[model samples]
Target: MAGNTEPLSPRAKLAVTAGKAAAAVSRAAGRGSGSVIGGRVALKLDPDLLGRLAQHLDVILVSATNGKTTTTRLIAEALRAAGPVVSNALGANMPAGITSALAGGSDAKFGVIEVDEKYLAGVARDTTPKAIALLNLSRDQLDRAAETRMMAEHWREGLSGSKAVVIANADDPLVVWAASSSANVVWVAAGQAWKDDAWSCPSCGGVMQRPGDDWFCGQCGFRRPAPSWALNGDYVLDPHGSAWPIHLQLPGRANKANAATSAAVAAVFGVPPQVALERMYQVQAVAGRYDVVTFQNRELRLLLAKNPAGWLETFSLIDPPPTPVILSVNARGADGTDTSWLWDVDYTQLAGHPIFVLGDRKLDLAVRLEVAGLDFRVCETLDEAVQYAPPGRIEVIANYTAFQDLRRRVGN
Candidate 1:
């Protein structure tokens, strides 16, 4: 289905211009990137602005509890092999930010959007995207965001009967339930590391029987679909039984899963799997994530882990023992006011690493670590944490706001 290709009304054009001006003012004031404010202004002036801007572009929306930004970036890069692609590359996924990105990339052939999990359905409805990628669903922002099953229901209802080809993760039960209602779906075995949220079936509310990699609901028989794409150790196997080696600068098996999914989505737009993987190799990091920056004369690799599922994947990316891992967390509004999610993560895995904790909610993390029988030193600042650690490349894992704060301090 083609997007709304009608010309923008005079008011819409004026709204876009005004939004750009507001964004410029915001940048000058050093308040922020200005995408949100600018988009908000334009949206307030023209409620239908996003639709008008997206009319001519083949939009692709990506949503997940984790890896949304990175996957979006990878997809954008891979799609570029076909044509110019515009995206919210800075990790802004809200309506306003999405509007701003669309407005700026008027001439681009494709729109690759990283959408927040809560806003995916609305954004998808407005954009009428050609494709949508549902990565995974787990507990995130427990106090603010809807429950995982509720969110999955919303996705299923919102996407029902849509013409978009959904590229969904077959390993995540919640994702399977969400994309089941779509008209077209291409499943990928992206691998779910944390299955705490999917123990119960969304279809029948029955206990999910997970034996090895296959999951099925005994009551309703809702089981994992055979995937058209699968991720092997170092290769991605396609539906045609062709295995393509994935060589990415990004680390961890999670990223490899993301690459497999990206290749599947890109193929929907006519980009070959080999070409997509080749283009994806150029993306070293998404926003500030996985970017190694020099802080206090020491190299620190930044990894963002906001929830238990994300932490599980992040732990696999960090260097092994004696690397001095700095764990930071915050309870700010952006990080979710409730810090109770810390208890869900298994901190005992870091038992041998020299651990230092710092953030607004460091005490909560420290307590969790202490209960796990791990020793940790709480610090007031990243600088202090670096000072206390023995000299070497430091691995830093932080939540939402804490990661942003450290990224700014490191000037990346």
Candidate 2:
């Protein structure tokens, strides 16, 4: 379903004007980027403001347990080769923030939206997106977010028979199940490193059989679909078996997977795979995920890992042994109230590195580390954590709120 391209209603115009004004006030007040506040105010005046604002543009929505922001950034950058593209580049993945972004980019030709996992269906419905990218789905914010299977079922029901082409990760069983209901899908074999959430089949609720990289449900016979695009080592193979080497400033195999998915989504919008990959290679970081900042006379590479799956990928991005690592964990509202997920992460992987833990939930992390038989020091602040570390480039891995806190402190 394409958005209505007609002129916005009087109410919607008023809402857009009001939202821009509110966002300007928020920026001036130094409260935030004001996307959410502006969007919220606009929606209050006109509930359908998002749909109206998105009417003129072909929108693409990206959602995942991890790498959504990076993939969104990649898609936006790649789509820019086509024309002006508007995106919530600041990691605002909700309705209000999305509305604010669209309100600001009214004249843009395309919209690339980073949608929160829970809100993907709703956002897709509202935006009438041209294409939707479903990256891997894993356990994230367990206390606040829906369980993996439940969320998949929600996506299946909401996106059933949708006109939009879905670019789904064929490697993830949950993502496959979610996009299975869509009439048109471009499957990409994006790697799924974290398999804890996909042990059970979403189809028949039976045990999922994994023979090598292939996944299938023996009882139900639900199997992984052959992908149109496959990530082979350092290259992304196109549908016709053309391999495009992925050279990204971003590290880790996870980012390579994201790039492969981004290329597939970009193809849906008519951007060539080579051109899309070239455009994506320019992106060094996403909303401060891989930013290197100087803090306390030490060079710190900031990495954000929110959940167990995210942490698994982050651990791969860190520097080698003996380079001190700072692990920050917070149980704030944005970080989720439950710190029990910390146990799910393989903290033992940081055995050789000098590990320092800090944040509101540092105690919980420390206990997890202790059980893993890794010695770690608990600090009160990031500065203290840095002070305790040896003199070298430090790798700092933090969860949502804690990462933001450190980012602010480092002025990055």
Best-fitting candidate, measured by lDDT?
A: 1
Q: Please list the C-alpha lDDT of all candidates, in the order they appear.
A: 0.94, 0.92
- What lDDT tens digits, residue by residue, belong to model 1 across residues 1-412? 3455777899999999999999999999988899999999999999999988998999999999999999999999999998999999998899999999999997788999999999999999899899999999999988999999999999999999899999999999999999999989999999999999999999999999999999999999999999999999999999899999999999999999999999999999999999999999999888889999888789999999999999999998888888899999999988899999999999888978999999988889999999999978999999999999987899999999999899888888
Candidate 1 deviant stretches above 4 angstroms:
1-4
Hey, what RMSD does candidate 1 come out at?
1.0
- Model 1 scores worst on lDDT over the 10 consecutive residues at 1-10
**TM-score, cand. 2:** 0.98
Give the root-mean-square deviation of each candidate in angstroms. 1.0, 1.2
Name the regions of candidate 2 deviating beyond 4 angstroms.
1-4
lDDT comparing candidate 2 with the true structure: 0.92
lDDT of 1: 0.94
